[model samples]
Target: MMIAIGYMLSWRKWFDEQSSRLIAKLVTQIALPAYMISTITHDFTAKRLLSTLPDLRFPVLSMLILFALAAVLIRVMQIKEEHRGLFESMFLNSNTVFIGLPVNMALFGNQSLPYVLVYYMANTTIFWTLGVWLIQRDGTHKQAFSLKTTLEKIFSPPLLGFIVGVLLVLFHIQLPQFILTDCSYIGGLTIPLSMFFIGIAIQRAGIQNVSLNRDSLGVLSGRFIFAPLLMTLLVLPMPVPILMKQVFILQSAMPVMTNAPVVAKLYHADEQYAAIMVTETTLLSLAVIPLLMMFVKSGFIT
Candidate 1:
C-alpha cells in the first residue's frame, strides 16, 4: 500500500526531480543510522547478547556459502561488468527486517523472534560491510581500492551506528531516556521513506519497462529457489532446535534486501534495475509463501 502511494505520487509529478535522491539520502544517512542504534540498544539486552552470538554463526555461515555460489553464478551467467557487484550482493543478502521479521512473527509466533533477530544481526552487519563494498563497484566512480576508501565505505553511517549501539550494550552504557525516545522517533521514518523510494523508482521505470529478462530471472531464482534450498541443506543437518532452523530457512527465502536499491541509488549504480528486481521478487514472494508454509507444516525441514 505504501509502495503504491509512492508510485502514485511520482506519477502525478507531486515531487521534484531530486526527490528520489533526497529520499535515499534521508534514509541511509539519517533514518537508518538512528534506526540501527535504537533497534540494537533496545532489542538486545546485556545478558542475552552474548548468548545470541553463538546463534549468529549460523547466518554468517549461510551468507558465506551464498556468497561463494553467487561468485560462481556471476562468471557462469556472464552478468554485465557493472552489475556483477550488485548481483552478488542481492543474490546473497535477504530483507530480514522489513519483510522477514513480520512474516516470521505471523507464521511462527513470538517464539521465533529471537532467532529472527539473530539472522537480522548477521544480515545487517554483512550488508553494510561487504554488501556495500560490492555496490560501490557497480557505481560510475572508478574505485582504486585504497585502505582509506575501503574503510570509509565499510564503516558507513549505518554500520557506525550499529557499532555504537553494540558497544553501548556490551559496555553496559545507557543513554538517557529522552535521547532513546528521540532516536526511536527519527529512526521510525526508515520504512515509509523506503516504500516511497520503491514507488518512485517503479513510477519512473514505468510498468512498460518492467520485464523478466535473464538478469531478472536469475535474481528471482536466487531469492526464491537457490536461497532457501541452500539454507535447507545447511540447517537440516544441524542439531539446533526445529524453530531456529525453520526461522533461518524462511528468512533465507525473504525478498531482496530493501537496502539494495537504496545503496545502488546512493552509489549511482543501476537503481532502476535494483528497483525492478525488488518489485518483482516482492510480488513473487507473496505467492511463494503459501507453498513455503506447507513445507514447514509438513515437517519438511524437521
Candidate 2:
C-alpha cells in the first residue's frame, strides 16, 4: 500500500521528517488544487454547482452541532485543560480533504467529487476560523486574529482551485485541452502523496506514543460515532441526492484534521499530544472504513 511504502521509506532512511512536510506542501499547495480544478470542470455544470452550494448548509449545520457537543464532551471527558481546545477541535473537525477525498473517490468515483468539495468548503472554512482559535486557546502562546492570515488560510489553494473551476463552469469558459491534461497529471499526485504523508507522519510521530485514554477515545467517538450519526440523521430526512448523502456520511467519519499537530505546535500547545491523537484517529479510520462502506452499501443507512 502507499502508506506502507511511505512508512518503509521513512524507516529505511529514505525519508526524513522534512519529507512529510514537503510532501504535504506538494499535495496541498500544488497537487490538490490541481485536482480540484480538474475534477470540478470535468464533472460539474453551473446548475449543479448552484444546487450544491445550498447543500453546504448540511455540513455547516452538522459541524455547529458537533461544536456544541465538543464543548460538553471535553468537560464530561475531563480532557486535560492544556489540551482541551485541541481535543474540542479534533472532536468536531474531520480530515475532509486528505483521507476524505481519496476514500470517497475510491468508493463512489469522480461523480462524488462535487459533493466532496461541498463538504471540504464548509470543513475548511470552519476549521481555519473557529477550530484554529480553539487550538490556539490550548496553547500558552496567544495570537490575535489576523484577517490577512485568516483569509489566506480560508482561501487556501484547494478552495481557490475549486473557485476557479466553478467560475470556468459558471461563465462557460474552457481551458485548452493540453492545459487540462497538464492539470490532470499534476492532480494525479494528490491521493498517493497524501497517503505517503500520513505513513511518514505516523512513523516520525512514533505511533508508539499514541495513547487510548479519555482524550483519544472521546475524539475517536466524535469522529466515528457522533459525526456520522448526526450527518446521517440530517441528510437522510432531507431530499438530497443519494451520492451527496453518502459523501456527507463518509466525510463526517474521516479522521481528525492532519493539521492538528501543526496548529498545536504553532501555538505552543501540546503538539506531542496532538500528534498522538492524529495518529490514533487516522489509524483507527483505516479499520473503520471497510465496515463503514459495507454498512453504507447494505442500504441500512439511507
Candidate 3:
C-alpha cells in the first residue's frame, strides 16, 4: 500500500504526459508481452495447465454473481441510464493483474503462480468479452469485439509468458540458462513499471471534481465490501481446494482495476465516476484486505 501511494506521490513531479504515454506504450505493447513469454516458458505443462482450469471455476462464477449484483444495485439506486454504465463497469473489472498478482505471489509463493496465471487468463477473457459487452450495451452504436483488442489483451506479454511456460512444462523442455536468466531480468520489471504507470495515470487524471458523498460512498461500499462479502459466502461453502479458495477470496477482495476508466471512456460511461470508484476502492482496500485475510485465517469468514 505504501508502495502504491509513493508511486502516486512521485508521479506528481516525475511523471509527465510524454512519459505517461511512453509507459503506456511499453506496458501495453512491449513489457506485457515480455512478461507473458517468460511466465509461459517457465510454468506451462499439460497436466499443470489442465489442473489450473478447475481453479478458475470459483473465480469466474464469483465474477458473474458480483456483476449481477452490481447491475441490480445500479437499478435499485435509480442511477440514470447514462450513469448506469459506470455502475455496471465497477462490478466486473477487479484488480487481477497489478495488485492481485503481486499480493498472491507474496502470500502463496511460486507454487501459486500457476493459479495466478489461470486467474488472469480467465480475467482478461471475461474483461474483453463480457465486460466490453456490458459497458457498451447502451452506446449509440454497439461496439463489436475487435480481434485486435482481443488478441492484444489475450497475448499481452504476461499472458504469453504463462502460455509458453505451460507449453514448455508440458513438453518437459528445458530452458537454456542464459534464456532463463534474461527472462528473469526482463520479467522483474512488470510489477514496478505497471504500478508506476498506474500512479502516473492517476496523477494525470487529477483528483478534482470527484463526487465523494453518499452516492460515491455507495459505489465504494459495493466494490470493496459488499461484493467480497457475497463472494466469501458463496466460495466458502464450495468444496474447492484451500489454495484455490484463498485465491478466489483474495482476488474478489481486490480493488477496482485501473482499466475501468479506460473501458468506461470507450463506452461513453461516466468516466469520472469510474475513476472515483477505482480511486476509492484502491485506497480503502489497504485496510479491508488485511482484515479480511485475518478473518479467513481464523475461519471466521469461512
Candidate 4:
C-alpha cells in the first residue's frame, strides 16, 4: 500500500524525475546499512550466529540449484541470445536487499534480520559472480570480465554493513549509545525510501507497458512460485527453525532484483525487457506477499 502510494505520487509528478534514483541511492547506501547495523546488533548475539551456521548453507545451495534449473529452462525455452542473461538473472537472483529486507522486517520483525542476512549473503555472492557474468556474457560489446569489479560489487555498502554488524556482535563490541540511536532513526528510512523508489520505477517504466507475454509469465513463475516452493521442499526436512523456513519462503517470493535493468543496461543486454520484468514482478508481489503470508500464518506448508 505504501509502495502504491509512492508510485501514484511519482506518476503525478509529486516527485521529480531525479527523485527515484536519488531515493534508490539513499536507501541502498545509507538508510539500508544503518538499518542493517542497528538490526543486526540489537537482535543477534555471537552464540546465536554460531548456532545458525548450519542453516545458512541452504540459501546458497538453493540459489545454485535454481541457477542450474534456470539454465536448463533457458535452453529448453530457446530464449533468444539477447534475453538469455536477463532471463537467467530474473529467475536466479532476487531483490533480497531492497524489497526482501523491508517485507521480512514488516512480517517477522527484527528477529528476521539474521535469517534475512543469511539469504542476503548468499544472494549477494551469486549475484556478483554468476549474475554479473551472465550480463556480461550476453552483452553486445562483450567486455572481458574483471575480478576487481565483481569484488567491488560484492562488497558494496549494504553487504559491508551486514559484515560489520556480524563482526560487532561476534566480538561483543558495543556501539556508542548516541550512535546506535542515530542509526536506528536513519535506518528507519529504508522501508519508505525503498517503497518510494519502487513507485518511481513503475512510473518511469509506465505501468501500462507491462506485458503478460510468455517470457514475463515464465519469469514470474520462476520467481514467486517455483523458487519459494523449491526452497520449502529443501528446507522442510531440515531441523532449522520454522521461522527460518518462513523467511526463506518470503524472500524467495520477492520481486526480481531491482538492479536487473541497471545491470542489463550496464552490460548492454536487453534493458527494456529487464525493466519491464522488474516492474511487473514488483507489482505482482504486492498481491503475492500478502497471500503467501496468510498461508504461512495458517501453517499450511509446515
Best by lDDT: 2
Off by over 4 Å in 4: none
Tens digits of lDDT, candidate 3, 228-256:
77767776777766676676677777877
**What are the C-alpha RMSDs, in order, of all predicted structures?**
4.1, 1.0, 2.9, 1.4
Off by over 4 Å in 1: 71-86, 95-142, 239-247, 257-275, 289-302
- Evaluate model 2: give its TM-score: 0.98
**lDDT of candidate 2 over 268-289, digit per residue (tens):** 9999888888888888888998
* Number of backbone clashes in candidate 2: 0
Residue pairs in clash, model 2: none
**RMSD (Cα, Å) of model 4:** 1.4
Q: How many collisions per candidate?
A: 0, 0, 20, 0
Model 1 Cα displacement at 71 (Å)? 4.8
User: Clashing residue pairs in candidate 4, if any?
Assistant: none
Ranking by TM-score: 2, 4, 3, 1
Query: What would the per-residue lDDT of candidate 1 be over residues 220-290, giving only the tens digit for each residue?
Result: 88889988898888889888788888888899998888778878987899988887787787767768877
Worst 10 residues of 3 by lDDT: 1-10
Better of 1 and 2 by TM-score: 2
Runs in model 3 deviating more than 4 A are 1-12, 24-46, 138-142, 145-148, 208-210, 213-215, 299-302
- Please give, for residues 173-214, the per-residue lDDT of candidate 4 as tens digits: 999999999989999999988888887888888888989866
Estimate candidate 4's alpha-carbon lDDT, on a 0 to 1 scale. 0.85
Give each model's whole-structure lDDT.
0.79, 0.89, 0.69, 0.85
